[model samples]
Target: MVSSTSEPTVVRVSQKGQATIPKGLREKFGIETPGEVFVYEDEGRIVVEPVPSPDELHGIHAEGHERGEATERLRELRDEEKRREAKRAERLRPSEDE
Candidate 1:
């Protein structure tokens, strides 16, 4: 089910509306079993791209940032968000005397 030429290869859809991706294309795109893919239509054509796992996406934005530093920054942001939520909840609580 692999295509050797650059020309588009034809495939048949199953009764369940599933089409098997060419083996060559799947290997080139890192598509794996139990993996996720993004499917969308643009203009008149459909496109399917593999979705990278969170582990694969880690450090994708590591522009001069250390991994540990990035993780610490995320933890700080989460703690700050939790503190803000707690303050907001306190302000919205009814007074015991009321």
Candidate 2:
């Protein structure tokens, strides 16, 4: 049940308990023929949210840095972690002479 300023549009549930989302609400929420939506209950009210595509989520974390810079930083961190693990393993290994 969606609330709006205008008169509330009543939707009839089919025999299978499926109700069609009103056209106006569908357009406002970007619900296409095959689009995905997240439906959950919030405070006893059902909430429907459109799921954005992966492309739409790209560069969402680019507020403080460029994508390439962030990727490079991640790579550097991974390399540093690998180096630390190798040093720890070497310290734990028995001497070859022993």
Candidate 3:
């Protein structure tokens, strides 16, 4: 498995394809009530990640950055992450010369 936490957890999916996240897992991931979680598939595996709501992220920049500035900063951070991921993939992929 790509990642492991204790043992595998079996969650029941309803007819609507909705599955409940285990409380322990939710708490460990900082999932909060009335919040949202990022769901996606990666490397043939399903991933569910906790994402801070806009309300939660408000005023995150303790250095007194304004709301608009903070939003731009968050966008910059996301773009930075994407660039880092691209670099990692480039390094891992086989070179054409190979």
Superposed model 1: Cα runs more than 4 Å off:
1-5, 60-98
Clashing pairs in 2: none
State in Å the error of residue 63, model 2.
12
RMSD of candidates 1 onward, in order = 18.5, 20.4, 7.0
The local lDDT score (0 to 100) that residue 63 gets in candidate 1 is 92
lDDT of 1 by residue, 1-98 (tens): 54663346799999999998888877776789767787766446565766655765577577976657655754565456457546865877898999
Q: List the residue pairs that clash in candidate 1.
A: none
Q: How large an RMSD does model 2 have?
A: 20.4
Candidate 3: stretches off by over 4 Å: 1-5, 53-98
Q: Is candidate 1 or candidate 3 better by lDDT?
A: 3
In model 2, the runs with Cα more than 4 Å from the true position are: 1-6, 60-98
Which candidate number has the best TM-score? 1
Q: What TM-score does candidate 2 get on C-alpha atoms?
A: 0.49
lDDT of 2: 0.64
lDDT of each: 0.68, 0.64, 0.68
